[model samples]
Target: MTKKQEYTGDYPEKTLYLPGPTEVREDVIEAMAEPMFGHRMDRMTDLYTTIVEDTKDFLDTDQEVIVLTASGTEFWEATTLNLVEDRMLVPTSGAFSERQANVAERLGKTVDRIEYDWGQAVKPDDIRDALEASDEGYDAVGMVMNETSTGVRNPVEEIGDLLGDYPDTYFVVDAISCLGGDYVDIEDHNIDCIFTSTQKAFAMPPGLAVCTVSDDAYEREVEKGDSSWYGGFRRTLDYYDRKGQTHSTPAIPIMLAYRKQMKHMLEEGHDARDERHREMAEYTRDWAREHFDLYPEGGYESQTVTCVENTRGIDVAETVETVSEEYDFVFSSGYGDIGEESFRIGHMGEHTVESVRELTDAIEDVAGL
Candidate 1:
C-alpha cells in the first residue's frame, strides 16, 4: 500500500453535502486537465457548441442557451438590467429569492414583492393578485424554483400558468440548485428566462453559469438598449450564433468539464436523473420525519435538498461541527434567521439515497437523538 505519489502537507478534504458545489466525478475533474487552447480557436468552438446544445437537449428546451464564466448570481443582474424596464414582481420565500429582489432594487429598478414566511411556498393566486393590482404593470416576475435557504420548491409552473394572462410580464426563475436534478418543463411552464450554476445539480465544479432564454426575453433585451455589457442576452447569444463561441474570454477548463459531465447526464437521461433525485428526496424526508419535522410546508418540499426542523433541541452548529470532525462530512445550517433552529441535507447532484443515509446516520450518532 505504499504511495506512488508523495503526500502533501495539511491537505484535508471534507465530503461536501451542501446544497451547491456538490460531489463531482473524477473523470469530470480530469476533463479539465486537457491541454489549454485559445478561446477563439476551432477547438473552443466545438467545446462550447457541444456543451450548449447538450444543455438544451438535457433541459429539453428549444430556447437559446448562454454559458458564462461566472456564478449564478450574474444572471440576477443580467435579467434585471435586460428585462425589467419598470417593475419586477418578486415573490420572497427565502434568502435567495429575497436576494433576487434586492439585486433589482440595487440596479435602480422598481421592485415589488409578495412576501411569505421563511419556509412557505409562493402562491399562484397571490402572484395573480399582485399583477392585477399593479397599476403601472410589471416588466418581469422573478422567482426561485428551488429555495436553497429553506428547502422550498415554489410553484413555478402554477405561477407560469397565471402569467399567461399577463404576457407583458416575463417569467424569470432561478433554478440554480435543482435544474439538472429535478424535472421542470421550461417551455410548457412559460418560463422566459431560467438560470443555474454548474456546481449544483450539474455535478460539476464551480465558475460556470448556464442559462436559457426565450425569444420574448431576447426581444426585451433588444428593446432595452442599456442592458448589461458583459451579460447582455443578445450580446452573448448573438456572438454564439455568429461564431459558436462566447463574446468574451470564457472559462475554458470549466467548460471542458461541463462537456464531459453533460455527456454523462445525457447518457443517464433526464427522466431517470430526475427520478433518482426524487428517490433520494423521499428517503431523506422519511428519515427526517422519523426524528424531526420538515421545515418547508408539506407537499411543497424541494426534491434536491431537505431542510429539517431541529425538534430534538440539538445544537445545530455544534452538531455540524462534530459531524465534520468525526465523520469528515459537512452539510449546511439553516439559512439566515433559521440558522440555529434547523439544518439542511442536500441530496442533489450524484447523491444517491444510500449516500444520504450515510450522512443521516452520522448525524444521528453525533446528535444522539
Candidate 2:
C-alpha cells in the first residue's frame, strides 16, 4: 500500500509571474474568509448581483454576464454547446485557440480551421477567406483573444468586426488570459460571447469563470433547445432575473473575493488597467529583445504575457527552477512544443513595470545573461 503524505499547513510563498493564477492581493484573499451564506439567502443576491453588474460596468457592456464556479475553459464548451448547432469556424494560431476548435469537435460539432503557425497571429483576411469558402453556413466562429501558449494576441476585435458581415454566425472569444487587463470593447466588437476566469488578469484565485452574452447568442440557444444545464445562458440569466443568484449552488467564498477584487478593478478603471498592461508589455518586450528574442510576430504580441525566445540558448527549466528556489520568483517555461525554445513572463494582474523588472533582474543574475 502507498503511504499518504503528512499534512502540513505551511507552504513556501513565491511571487507568481506565470500567465494564469497570477498573484492575488492579500485583501482579496481575506475576503474569501467571510462568513458563509446560503445560495438562496439575500446576501447571496447581493454578492451575485454586485459582481455581475460590476463586471458589466468594468467591461463597459450591456450584455448579460454569467459567473460560474469553473475555469475559463468551461465557456469553451458552453459557447460551443449553446451556439453551435452543426458547423463552426475556428482560426488556430496557438495552443489555446486549437483547444477551442477541439472542444467543438469533441462536442460532435463540425469544426473547420484556418491554421497558422504557433507563434503567428490569426489574420482577419484568413478568417474572411475561410468564411467565404464555406459552402454550408456556419453556426458560429470562435477564436482566442490572447493565445497564452505563445504570448500572441490575435486581432479578435478585427475578427469580430469581420464577423459582423455574417450576422447569422455567432462570434465566441476566449479572452481567458487577458480580459480584465486587456480591456476589450465587447459590445463595439459585435462579439456574441466572451469569457475569462478570475485567475488571470483579474488578479484573483482560481474558481470562477465569467462571460458576457449577447441577446442574439441567448436566443440562438433557445432556438436550438438543447442547451447545457449548468452553463446555459437562458437558465442562469433567467434565474438571476427572477432571483438574483446562480441557478446552481455557487462558490460563495470565491464570490466574496470577486466582489472585493472587482472594486479594485473598478477603481483602476478599464482604460487605466489597459494602459498599465500596455506599459508592462512594452517593458517586457524591450527586455526580451535586449537579452533574447520574442516568440510572437512583431506588432501582435500579448499585453499580459510575453514569450521570450531562448536566443542565448540557456537551459530554460534549470533557470526557472533556480529562480524559484533562489529568488522565490516563479515565471513560466514555454508551453507545449516550444517548451525548451522559449520562456514566458506574465505581467498582468497588479504587476507594474518596476515589479516585472525584479523578475528580469533575477533572470539575468541566475542565467548569467
Candidate 3:
C-alpha cells in the first residue's frame, strides 16, 4: 500500500512573515511536484497555455497576456522600449517605482518624475495634473499598485480613471505585490498595461512575470519595427503565435503549481480571498496602531502586508532572530535605511486568521509587547 504524504503540525514549518515569498498551501506545494513535461510538447502548451488564458479571464481583460521567464523588471524594459519613444512621466511613492524611472533614464529615455513623500499614495489628482501639464503628453506614466517598501497601497483605480481620455499616454502598473489578494478590474479600469510577478500573491514560486497589454499597446509593440527580441514583447508574442509555446523550458514545477493555485484561488473565490486579506490587514493594523505607528497614513494602508513603526524600542533584528530561532516564524526587518526603526509582516496567501493570531502571539511573547 502506498503511504499518504501529509504534514501535521507536530513539527512547525518555516512560516514566512516577510513579504515576497509568503506561505503557500500544502496542496499547492504538492501540485508543484508534478512530473516535468516537455516545454516543446503539446501537453506543455495545453497546461500553461490555459494558465495564460485563464489569467486573462481572472483579470477581466481581453488583452493578450505574455508570460515571461523573468521578473517584473523585464517588463520595465519591454514597456519602455515598445511603447515609449521619447519621455516618460513617472510618478513614484516608494523605492520600486523610483527604480522604474531610473530604468527609463538608464535606457536613455528622458524621464520626468513626479515623486511623493514616502509612505503616501500617488493621488489621482496628481496623475491628472501631471498628464495635463506635460507639453509632450508623456510617452507613458507608470506606478506601482502596492509599494512593498512601506506597505502603502496606491489608489490605482482612481489614477486609471484620471488618465481616461489620454489616448496618447500609456498607463502602466507594477502590480507585483498585490495580484492575488488585491482585486483589480483591468478592462473597466482602462489600464493600458498591468505587470505582476508570480511569487508574491500568486501563491507560486518566483520565475514568471505576467503582463496584460491593451490592443493599442499590442499594436505599438508590433509596429515598433523590432526593438528587442530576447526578453522583449516580440519573443513572447511570437512564441504564442508560432508554436503556442513559451520562449524557454519554463520553471515547469512553478507552472504546474500555478494551475493548482489558480484553481484554488478561483474555487475559494476572488471575493473571499480579497476579503480575507483585508480582514487580516485590518486586524494587524489595529494591533499595530495600538502598539506602534503605521508606516503609512491611517486611512491608506496595504491589505496584503503592513509596515509597523517600532515604538517600543525593541531591537527589531534581535526580536526577529529570537522569535525565528525560538518558534520558526520569520518576519521582515525594515528595508534599506529604515531597517532599524521599522519592520514588516506579511499576511497573505494560505495563512488563515488563526495563523495570523499565532504570529501575533509569537511576537507578543518574544518581544513582551
**Candidate 1, residue 178: how far the Cα is off, in Å:** 0.9
Residue-level lDDT for 297 in candidate 1:
97
- Per-residue lDDT of model 2, residues 1-369, tens digit only: 989999797878999999988999999999999777899999899999999999999999999999999999999999999999999999898888989999899999999998999899999998888889888879998999999999999898898888899999999999999998898888888998999999999999899999999999999999999988889999999999999999889999999999999999999999999999999999999999999999999999999999999999999999999999999999999998899899999999999999999999999999998
What range of 10 consecutive residues in model 3 has the weakest lDDT sum?
224-233
Best by TM-score: 2
Tens digits of lDDT, candidate 3, 1-369: 999978765866688877878887788788877766788989988887888877876766788888777888888888888888887888887888899899988888998888887788878887888888877788788888888888999888988887777877888888888888888888777788898888788777788888988888778767766555655666777778787788877777888877778787777777788888888898999889888888986677998889998888889999899889898999898878778788899888777778888888898999988
In TM-score terms, candidate 1 sits at: 0.97
For model 2, the superposed segments whose C-alpha errors exceed 4 Å read 1-7
TM agreement with the true structure for every prediction: 0.97, 0.98, 0.93
Q: In candidate 1, residue 339 scores what lDDT?
A: 93
What's the C-alpha lDDT at position 179 in model 2?
A: 93
Instruction: TM-score for candidate 3, please give it.
Output: 0.93
Model 1, 69: alpha-carbon shift in Å?
0.3
Q: CA lDDT of each candidate?
A: 0.94, 0.94, 0.83
Error of 3 at 353 (Å): 2.0
